[model samples]
Target: MTYSASANRYDTMAYRRSGQSGLKLPAISLGLWHNFGGIDTFERGREMIRRAFDLGITHFDLANNYGPPAGSAETTFGGILKADFLPYRDEMIISTKAGYYMWPGPYGEWGSKKSLVSSLDQSLKRMGLDYVDIYYHHRPDPNTPLEETMAALDLIVRQGKALYVGLSNYSPEQTREASRILKRLGTPCLIHQPQYSMLARGPEAGLLDVLDEEGIGSIVFSPLAKGILTDRYLNGIAPDSRAAGPSAFLNPDELTEETLDKVRALNAMAGERGQKLSQMALAWVLRGGRVTSALIGASRVSQIDDAVEALRGLEFTSEELARIEAILA
Candidate 1:
């Protein structure tokens, strides 16, 4: 199906602003970090992108290193873009990242200008696009000079390869430093993609405020905490859950007795709100204005449908907030 065909349904989901920029990202954006990988058939990956657009999700996040075989996710997604979403390319915000391992060699990864610039060109070629809506440095590299990375990002925007620049997995201090450098280069970092969830409050440690002050938007990844904050693990690990996946990001060790107890309490709180744990988790992230969007992943259409439904009642009482904090406490 094409975007014009899906345009009617696309207006159903709310679109939030990206930092101080003119771009407004869908409340629920799809990420190609996992299921839409080389491990799956291209048809399966394309189907997810089509379904997402039909469900009003217009922002697609990807990286050069997403597929199990590195570049295959972009290649697969590029096919879908050409066949289906190409007509609505201007209507969509497609993002890709660098700064992670993509190829073999000493210069293949990290924050160097050589890596970021070359990786983005390869990413665009793989995605069959001339320019991405936003280009990101996947993560901060301690070894590479910060100025080099910022300069590379600025170069992309100036060269019209990427309209905006962003950083991911950056600490508050690193974000501030990058912001200053990007400003000096006159490209200004547009957003920060951090992992935030009811279970992971690391962003609250200071990153949110840093982004806010610098006028950088935040679109949080794993807002469901890799499905841990979802109902999938409330009782026990499901046979098909991430706990069963290959990612070290969510290990069995993380499911400590204390963590499970917290999950149980959170589930009870969800019941009081008349929402599932996953729905509640998504809503919790939207409660604050600082979060521009929640980057989510799904194995099935039902998960996307449920996340959309949660947005219908995205509000919590002060008492409920206190109770949630008490549970997490």
Candidate 2:
């Protein structure tokens, strides 16, 4: 069956400029970090991708180490792209990253030119694409020189393997230096990917400021805090939940009584705002104009619908903001 995208797909969704770059990302993008791998059903993953595209989610994020067996998510995504998304390639922004133990040996990971370049080539082949819209260094390598990593990114752009370069999980100081080096190399940093949500406020302290200062945009990941802010855990965790599964990212122990109490309180506030807990959580992340997009992970098509509805309640009054801060504090 041929997949024809919704005619009004671009009508309702909001697109925001990524910092000072010409690229504009959808306010809500999808991440394939989990549940789109070899371990999961291919049909379900394909349906999620189709549903997301129908809802105007133009960006899909990936990384080298995303799957359980590593790199399987890209393979799965590649298959989907080949089948349904190939026709819409120009209308979408695809991104993938490298860093963090991809292979067994020392050279398999980290920020070396070899690691970053080779990993991206492999990612391109796995995804069956000529070039990715954005390529990211998954994390900062403490031991690798910033010049080498930034140069590798510059080289990628020059090689036409990637159109723009970004950084992920980098601190304020690290971002500043990398942005400086990239600027010197004539490849200005386009955006930054970081973990930011109600539960994770580390970015609020100084990371956002740095991005603003450097003229770099931010697309936040884990905006729901691994489903902690959603109603899925309002009751006890389901046996099939990610927490109950074999995911190292989300564990059953993370759902502490204290966390649940906070989530319940937040859920109540969301009700007052006429939104679901997940919707409110996503809106909260994008409340301020600082964040360019909220990168979400979905196991099902309905999760994408819920996230799109979040755009409706993005604005909040001062009182609501204060109350949310108080609850989080």
Candidate 3:
């Protein structure tokens, strides 16, 4: 597909299929979870999104409460859609979620039919789109029945508000329950987004198996482990790194001596492979066919270039894999 000058860089990025689905997603996707809020300059955010698209990142992920004040990320993204991406909507895959606390009272969050339905409408209004490529539950809600959430997803698809449904942060059992309900409703659950990286192997515990059995795709967020697996922390936390940011997701203290030792050892292995620690970490996640793509965040274009370069050195020898496992041990 052809795009404007700002989007011409897409030819450099690789695209991977979402499980058995006919749709293919860029091997790496841009996320609006950070730095694309109402407070951030819309021009910069637009440039980043445009650059990502140019680099073949067709999928953009967002949620109702992505901004610091809530809803601002969606609002900002909506403006970008109207200003630049609306004309090329067919070339993009947009996704938004609803299962988080956004407003007062009980109807604001969770997987209830009322909450999911209302949040989706609000998301479409904020994005100024007729339909999002994917709509997610955001997070599983124990208080709401699984059927209610699945039914709500079914209604969303039927209403043309979203083409496919996704679930985020749901455990293996919860995913199974929701998948069963969605299957019964005839709305196939297409993807599951979770936090997965070499440092965080929680998904490999059982989530991957469940997805394989159910024929559902997996997209991993924080696949770089919030930059911990990167060489940035090997020398200690940088002044402007996420570890120094106010966000609670990444902490400087978590840079324990043990973890740092592991990071150094992993860096040595990456050096032998002629790749950066960050690139190798990302490539590691994509090594298994079970992963569809790695959802990543970046503060600069150079980081984007470096991360994308990792795709060229994704291969690893069996011995190399064993050495990496031993280091993690």
Highest TM-score against the true fold, candidate: 2
The alpha-carbon lDDT assigned to residue 114 of candidate 3 equals 91
What lDDT would each prediction earn against the true structure? 0.87, 0.94, 0.86
For every model in order, what is the number of clashing pairs? 0, 0, 5
Q: Which runs of model 1 end up more than 4 angstroms from their true locations?
A: 1-4, 246-249
Q: Model 2 off-target regions past 4 Å? A: none
lDDT of 2 at 304: 98
Question: Which pairs of residues clash in candidate 3, taking residues 3 or more apart in a chain or in different chains?
Answer: 7-54, 9-54, 10-54, 10-55, 10-56
Q: lDDT by residue for model 1 over 120-167, one digit each (tens)? A: 999999999999999999999999899998999999999999999999
Could you give the candidate ranking by lDDT, starting with the highest?
A: 2, 1, 3
Question: Distance (Å) between predicted and true CA of 273, model 3?
Answer: 1.6
Number of the top candidate by lDDT? 2
Query: Candidate 2 lDDT, tens digit per residue, 1-329?
Result: 88889999998899999999999999999999999888889999999999888999999999988886699999999999999988899999999999989987878998999999999999999999999999999999999999999999999999999999999999999999999999999999999999999999999889999999999999999999999999999887888887777666687788899999999999999999999999999998898789999999998889999999999989999999999989878
TM-score of 2: 0.99
Q: What is the lDDT of residue 154 in candidate 3?
A: 97
